[model samples]
Target: MDVLLTVVVPVYAVEGYLYQCLESIRAGLTAEENAQVEVIAVDDASPDSCGLMLDGYATRHGDLRVVHLTSNVGLGLARNAGLVEARGKYVWFVDSDDWLPSGSIRAVLDKLRETEPDVLLIDHLRVHENGRLQTDASSPMLRGTVTLDRLLAVQHTAWNRIMRRDFLTKHDLRFPAGWYEDVPFSNPVLLAAERVEVLDRVCYHYRVGRFGAITATRSERHFEAFEQWDRLYAWLDATGVDQALRIRLFTLMISHLLVVAGNDSRVHPRRRRQFFRRIAGLYRRHRPEGYQPPVGTPGIKHRLVAINSYAMYSALRTGYRVAGLRRRSTERTPVVSQDLPSAPQRVQTTSLR
Candidate 1:
């Protein structure tokens, strides 16, 4: 059967919630729609039973194919492997721990088939561990015209988008191999896409807060976030993108650095000083002239980075912790202790191996 939409799921050590994620897809599609859907589950050598579970599911569902990797290549490579095997008009990515709301598959397929966009953007519901549910913060700006600015302005999530398989292949878009891989991949897709559309509906049910989740834990690998952005910058710059858009990316770069630093509490204090040394130089190199951080604590932190002042940033962070004001955002209640915004979760990938 000619596939209409291919759902690529990268599986890792998510046995705790894998079933719900897959069941949602099963429950979402109708008999007719299911016929045109192809599900590819990439098992990243998960030590857990996730791979075995996927194999069993494939036996039951004729359209679902299970690809088990011999070793763990991280989420980026796993998704890339699936993309290589995908034979569908459109491609959709769903985290192994996250699920589709009932009927989401059908709704997304309808839009993809009708509009036939190079990429389709959809809103998601973020479900926090504390039972807090918030609509994606970018709903207002993600819709309407498909300008480079607006598209770049929205969340850069691989799962929240459905792109034409040809569009991705034609552009050679693939996720980078490690932390913060989504942005480098998503940004290019957004930039290359000729026609993009936003579906106002909330089709994705995203789950946050796991004991070992990426947002919850931070270590040396976090530095890869910058390297990821640098690769993206090179890609965009090669295309001769407008300077204005490059400035926007620079602003985003600063914001992401702060957010990554804020989310990380596991680093040793001395190591952080070393970390800041390397990142501060990057901040100086990447920040556009006359750029200011967005208002609030994150902005203040960004200024510290801009000035290359690790000492000052440390002092303010200590003051906030001592004053018991570190968790507060300038806007609303933060889903996580991280000073980041209400954006989509960047670490929502397979937890295998």
Candidate 2:
């Protein structure tokens, strides 16, 4: 039987999580079901023993294939390497630091058989360090509709979506190297896809707040977010996506940039002002004519950004941060706080490990 899905996991220093991640791929599936799935774990020259561990695991499990790179490439290029080795009809990129839920493989296979969509969007929950599970804020929005605007509105993580191999290859949709690489790759796949389906069930568990994890750590590389978005902007101009769609994308871009700039975890306090100014520069260059900002606090932010008011924005951020701290102290549940405009979750293009 031919492989129906190829699961590509880019592994770096995820020694603690790699075992569970690989095991989850075959957890609830029978031998026959497992036969129809190909697992490729790319060891991106991990500094730990992950490469050696992968070799041993592949030897013990005949179906698992391991790719050992000579040097550490970031997450985007590592996934691209795994894509080249995939032979299945469809491909799913699973992060090594995360794992699939039980029976997810069977669920995905069944969905693919039923819909045969060029792109399949799946729901996921954010798994906190304290064992709390919070549904992705965008989960409710994932439905039968496959419009480009709706697709763009959903979270931009690659792991939450499964794509047909031929569709990706035909469009030459490979991830670019740098942070926020998903910005360029995920949007274009959705835009070019002819058929799309959504599996509303939670198929994956996204690990959050893990020590040394990409989304959790502070890094100057967050600046790459602007360049990555620029890549998509270039694509939009080249493809001549409709003016309305361009506006929608532009709105999303501002929201995403604000999220990054205001995020204390991603951008350091010292560099926050610089990041905000850079975002304001982007706003001036790309803000659509006659564009109306969204309502509420986010709208206020858009208006502030329009005038390049970093001082005002910083004051507003201070207020939000104070309010968020109060809420956190009162609430016991481990909730991921969102104090900025509604946008896709901030994803790191580098290895989560």
Candidate 3:
């Protein structure tokens, strides 16, 4: 039978939630769609029962297959391995820790047939430990019709998206083995796609503030994000995107730096200066013509960076610490990528939390 979609699940140390993820996948696909759907679950050397659990599930479902890796490879490489075995016309990358809503796969398959796009973007809900579900505001681009110009404002995330296998192969896209690898892998493909569609329906649940989640951990490995940004720039330069797209991409890059150096509480307070300096250097290196930061916190950081005012940056950051204002850049520093934890601040679990 011809396969309609191949779901690639990369598992690593997600044993606690792996069962829910896999179960969601199984239940979402109706029995009628069973033959048309296949799952490629990669156990990336998880030192837990995940591999065994996957094997057990595979035994029950002939359409589901599990690949056991001999050694521990990061998420990016594990995804690359899954791509090697994908045999469907469309490929969906589902994180092992996250699950899809009921009947999402069938809905997505219907949407795919509606317009065979190069990529289909689905809406996602961020679920916190407290059971708080955050559905982002309705997007104009996702509604009615979308254009590349409008998509410039939309962020490119790896998950909650389905890509044509041939489109990905044509672009020769591969996930890099490092932190924030999504930047390089997703951005280029999104920009290169001739037909991109965004669905407003929430299909996936992205969990935050969950124990053992990669995002929940703060460490120097976060600095690897900078390398990811550099890779993104290199790809953009090589592909020769239009000037408008280049400016938009640069704007997002600048915004990421501002968020990391200013508002992200994961950064160590001692390393805030280094983070600021790095952001400054990036802006200087990649600032495109007619570049102006978006109004608000990011714009403030841009003004400070323009003047090379580290003193202003420090003073503003200190104000945020003392005033206890959220969403303001220059939060208690260390920015995880620094390879150090915040000495002044440790994990604080409050009653409300």
Q: Name the top TM-score candidate.
A: 2
Model 2: per-residue lDDT, tens digit, 28-146?
Answer: 78888888999999999999999999999999988799999999889999999999999999999999989887778888898888878898888788888877777776666675444
Model 1 vs truth, CA RMSD: 6.6
Per-prediction CA RMSD (Å): 6.6, 6.4, 9.5
Residue lDDT tens for model 1, 262-295? 5556455667777677677877766665566778
What's the TM-score of each model vs. the native?
0.86, 0.91, 0.87
lDDT of 3 by residue, 92-137 (tens): 9999988887767777787787778888887677777766666554
Ranking by TM-score: 2, 3, 1
Residue 345, model 2: lDDT of: 46
Model 1 poorest ten-residue lDDT run: 344-353
Q: Candidate 2, 146: how far from true, in Å? A: 5.5
lDDT of 2 at 233: 84
Model 2 ranges off by over 4 Å: 144-146, 327-353
Residue 192, candidate 2: how far off, in angstroms? 0.7
> Model 1, which residues run further than 4 Å from truth?
143-147, 265-270, 289-298, 321-353
Q: How far is candidate 3 from the true structure (C-alpha RMSD, Å)?
A: 9.5
